[model samples]
Target: MASASTANRWLRPEVYPLFAAVGVAVGICGFQLVRNICINPEVRVSKEGRSAGVLENYAEGEKYAEHGLRKFLRTRAPEIMPSINRFFADPK
Candidate 1:
């Protein structure tokens, strides 16, 4: 048996951040697992398809392993705060 205060301690505002952090971590891990299962050639389940050569498999693995978002961003500037970056980068 536990006291009401002891049970209520877990619901305090101070515990909310920990809960949020855990939720985010779980979500990220789940997404990665699903992505790998779906696209990572080594882990992806193959159906009846045309047999591929070794070179083709390697090329496909590289393409499928890269997330679409990462591929899209690869050509773009890595800027978290674009406005601030431009302001600081500009010569007076």
Candidate 2:
């Protein structure tokens, strides 16, 4: 159909930069999300050691969500940011 063919236009060279920009934005958002979580629990981590820290943050976030998933996700999630940073910044 005409609509399907038009979708293929995104593959053209002119749109490559648009794709790249979106990729970068998504990557940064992902990285920030992980960083915000893993740095909780008052644990200090080095720069390189943080590669897997996001997983820890996710687990901690689960506990924080026990109150109410949808509500807590929007309101209290930021509470962990400072604690996580403190932990992640500590010298091991």
Q: Best lDDT goes to which candidate?
A: 1
For candidate 2, what is the total of clashing residue pairs? 8
What is the per-residue lDDT of model 2 for residues 1-92, given as tens digits with 9 covering 90 to 100? 98888988767899999999999999999986786666444343666655545454666656554545567577654665777887888778
**Candidate 1 — which residues are off by over 4 angstroms?**
1-3, 44-56
Worst 10 residues of 1 by lDDT: 47-56
lDDT of each: 0.79, 0.69
Estimate the TM-score of every prediction: 0.71, 0.40
Best by TM-score: 1
The total of clashing pairs for model 1 equals 0
lDDT of 1 by residue, 24-76 (tens): 99999999899877767666355533244233477787787576888999998
The residue pairs found clashing in candidate 2 are 37-57, 39-84, 40-84, 42-87, 43-87, 44-87, 44-90, 45-88
Error at 16, model 1, angstroms: 1.2
